[model samples]
Target: MQTCKILQDISALQVLSINISRRCFYTTTTTSPLPWLFVGLGNPGEKYQGTRHNVGFDMIDVLAKSHGISMDRVHCKAIFGQGLISDVPVFLAKPQTYMNLSGESAGPLAAYYKLPLSRIVAFFDDMNLPCGVLRLQDKGGNGRHKGVRSLIHHFRGNSEFARLRIGIGRPPGQMDPKAFLLQKFNATARERIDVGLQEGVGALKLLASRGLTESARCFNKEQKYKHIRVQTLET
Candidate 1:
């Protein structure tokens, strides 16, 4: 698994060098408030559903359901919906270029919408934390996540985009991370995972309305999801 991650990092660097011109022109004019782009990374296809790696897509579904955003339109190599979440206009995107090439979709979508990297959120699963936990950050490196690596690569190594990482926990001893990521959540962990997903949606909503500091406080403290209490939570 570690070897695979290293290879992915090398591959990303190579791709980043060639895709340096992914940035697009932007217009200064605007009538409405700037929109937010929430990107959920996952491989396309029903076979991938319910897998650890696809948790981002699962929560994106939760967000879209809560906001009444229909994600039927395809654009910029992703399926997305534009609508308001907590009265904040937002776009929820699921990239179809698979996991490692997420930026092939996300980068262009952000460019087309003229949304700055600061307002974009990358939601994905994290093995660094235990299940039933979450970590919301204003910005940071992707660690070893190739999907995020791809985004950073396309953004010219800029990790300024916000990220919401749902803790799926590391694979059990001696397991390959790739196999672990592709496995479906079993009954044993389902409850905790579901709870974490719910809390993640709340954290994401707060991020859209209340800003990163508060959202991080609500999501990323050492206590994690089990004990933290957040006020005025809606989205």
Candidate 2:
């Protein structure tokens, strides 16, 4: 998973701003206004696909399917597509820089499109809640998430952007959280994830129509009553 190497690189560049490789992520034919940039965080390659850590990627796939987003172009170290959601133009991205350097892929894309931090929505897995429970927060601290910490650093310490948090539950027994993130979901977990992903699809639509506050309130309220178990992560 290159997890060790990513950790080393993060430490080396902890205080330094390094040049990132350029990628051609944009090929939009939209004459309409740019819709919100929805970035799904995950590692690249087959081993990572369908794993708990790739829930963001899975959500991107769901959104693209429901909204006709092709995700045909690879740029900025991500594969993305432009499509309309209920008449709103939106860009979907799945970053290819593993997981720890997601900010490197997202920051440049934001600059490329001249989009403000407020216009971006980051969707990633969260370990705090049971599987299938989602948290929609306007802004908050990274809670020590390494990928999110990287984004905060790259954004010049700004953490005001919108976030769509999907719960993946905690590790079982004493298993390493890192290992848990890479493992694919079990059958029972997948059954529940399908439900959560449907909610996530609805949540994204709500974000496009309703503002962030209303959307968060609409989705987060369900978590209080629903007791679900699932696995996912965003580090």
Candidate 3:
């Protein structure tokens, strides 16, 4: 009788251990949804406003206004705001660490939020693309953009973060690229950029509601075909 009682107690203990193990497995495998981080790269200061290089900053402003995300706080070396888009939490940041050192702000924001690279999207100017054109890409090399280079460096060499590349076009003949970047767009280009910003807001909303892949597929296709027509007209 004593041996039988001991066996029954042992069996109970084993069952309890199995239940605990199952709970642990469930806790480890299940995760809540993570927020998205949208970072705009540009130099901060009144002087840089409206310049080609500051399009990223302009984009942030447009997004904040459209979504009612108040960028009224300074955090992680950036002008920061948080709000919901389609009930999904989203963070918007404009790095105040200047363009080349954007990572100083971006890296800490990601770490603080414990976000993966896939959940982060950066907005910045791209000279390789024609003015008024935009590109959304999941991952790529920095393409010699200083702000992007800094981000890659701070991400521990990880370059998998998505980007919304706003085109400002290349410098015209014999003009210094640096000089052009700091120049305000002429009237024609300014009109194009304004139109582009509105379009960008739509694309971003789609991104938040649907997802990166779907948003990119729809946005990029329209932009590609539209730009092709524009180029043909100019030529």
Candidate 4:
């Protein structure tokens, strides 16, 4: 599995307003009234597929599948595709650079589209929460995530972006963070993730068609699955 880590925390509240790139690509096809750039944050390559940290990629895959779009090509140093949800143009991207350089790919893409960070939403994993949970925030701190840090850097200190954090839970016992994120989810974890991915796609649909505030209010902090423990008395 592919693994990487970032060494700093970036607060979205401290974004700057400069260095915006000048490139824009328009989708002639009409899908939705609002156009957005959706970025799925994760390392690139086949080895990382199915890992807990790749949940962002997984969510994008789920959304593309639902829209009958295939993410099978490279563009802007990432895999990307275009599709419309409720007449809104959505550019889906999976950064080619490893997680730490995710912003390098995303920043240019957003700037090229003439879109503000506000229209750009990133999906990524969060270790502070329990597995199978999802959080949607209009704007906030990066929580020390490498990909988000890089993105903030690329934006030159812009924090108006939307972020969707999927919980992968804390590492087991004292397992290394790198190792834990690289590990595949167990059967139960996969089931929970599958359902969560579906929910994530629905949230994306809402975010693209509706608005961030509406989408966050509807799906943020909502869990698609619940964990129930069964105990048996000693016999």
Candidate 5:
């Protein structure tokens, strides 16, 4: 009887091993594509429309219009839209939680989608670059931007997600930074921003078609060259 008991235990172990192997196989063979989440950080409402701080929202609008994606859904505290770009699934969001609390919307949307941090990209304004200049980086800390700081906090201090910085330039000569952000662009600035938005759309299309790394590499190189020329001309 003892010998029979030992044999039964061995048989159970074999069954468990088979089940584990099958589970591994299933996991390894699954090939469903994960969608990319593109979040634009900005304050909601018409009060902030066309302000320097709302350029991120402008980007989302341009992208939606270009792709025919309707921004009619509210999800995770954001105006959300989803569509296919070159057969790649894409989700666009403009956080309605305002600029400072943008994470309240972005973080939950990422969690709800179950996307890896690598597949998430945020667009927001930056004062460090020249007006209408843009930069795309894989990951970085918040560059004194409250919206970015909030996102970092909600991401549990994980700054591994991607971001595209839309430059609004530094506040002019002692001008209050906050006031500068809320101000509408002048005609010249508006023209530059419009051009920047068009370039941004092209970069995003490349991102959807190729990927973050390749898109960032190509886009940043062109932007850097353009920036150098602008600086040379200014000086």
Candidate 6:
């Protein structure tokens, strides 16, 4: 899909050389707030659709719904909603390039906009946290995620961007991590995913408007749904 004309003034049009080549993706002719990019990491194609690893995409979908945003048909990209969060234009994207190569789509988009690494927020699934839990961090190591690793590589190992991680639970004993991520969410786990999705949506908005630290503080207290811990008397 082509970019909207509003985005042209931001250097994306020049980066793609649309004027000289006449080959443009989309054109938006509107003014907007400082452009911020949101990348939801996941594998491409129907086969991986709705899988646990696609929680990032799923969360973005929820965010769109909450804000009345719609996805526009862009070439090789699932993009939609050029609207305001705190009156700032935010671009939402789910890379069709699939996980592991997410940077292939996001890296260029970031460069084209001349956006600081700090302005990019990557939403993705995390196995370390318990199901229904959410965490927002400024930056960190990939922690065994190939997709994140690829993004880090494309950005030349800069982890200064914000990350919103949604827990997808861990694999059962002896199960392959890749296989598990590709698996659909179990019936019992659906509730947690729903709750996490809601929290993720809220966190995304807060992150976009307020900043990462504020969002992190708001979401860090969401562990109540994961499980309740109690003290016991020792004999």
Who wins the lDDT comparison? 3
State the lDDT at 78 in candidate 4: 85
Model 6, runs deviating above 4 Å: 1-33, 75-80, 224-235
Please rank every candidate by lDDT, starting with the best: 3, 5, 1, 2, 4, 6
Clashes (N, CA, C under 3 Å) per candidate = 0, 3, 0, 10, 0, 14
Tens-digit lDDT string for candidate 5 (1-235): 9999999999999998888666551233346356789899898888999999999999999988999999999999999999877767889999999999999999999888778899998999999888878998999999889999998899988999999899888898999999999999999888888888889999998998898899999999988987887677657
Better model by TM-score: candidate 1 vs candidate 2 = 2
On the 0 to 100 scale, the lDDT of residue 229 in model 5 is: 74
CA lDDT of each candidate?
Answer: 0.83, 0.81, 0.91, 0.79, 0.89, 0.76
Instruction: Please identify model 3 stretches exceeding 4 Å from their true place.
Output: 1-32
Error of 5 at 104 (Å): 0.4
Please provide, for model 2 over 185-223, each residue's C-alpha lDDT reduced to its tens digit, 9 standing for 90 to 100: 999777767788888888879878866788878887876
lDDT of 3 by residue, 4-105 (tens): 999999999999888876655123333534678999999989899999999999999998998899999999999999987776678999999999999999
lDDT of 4 by residue, 1-235 (tens): 1222222223232232122211223433344254688899887778998998899888888888999877877878889988787667788999989898998889888877678778888999998756777878888777899889998999998777988888887887988999999999999878878877888888888887778888888785454323221111111
Query: What tens-digit string does per-residue lDDT give for candidate 1 at 17-95?
Result: 5565353222233444567899999889989999999988888998898778899999999998888777678899999
lDDT of 6 by residue, 65-95 (tens): 7887777755235454555666556778888
lDDT of model number 4: 0.79
Query: Worst 10-residue stretch by lDDT in candidate 5?
Result: 23-32
- Please identify model 2 stretches exceeding 4 Å from their true place: 1-34, 227-235
Using TM-score as the yardstick, the better of models 1 and 5 is 5
Positional deviation of residue 80's Cα in model 6 after best superposition, in angstroms? 4.6
Candidate 1 vs candidate 2: the lDDT winner is: 1
lDDT of 1: 0.83
lDDT for model 6, please. Answer: 0.76
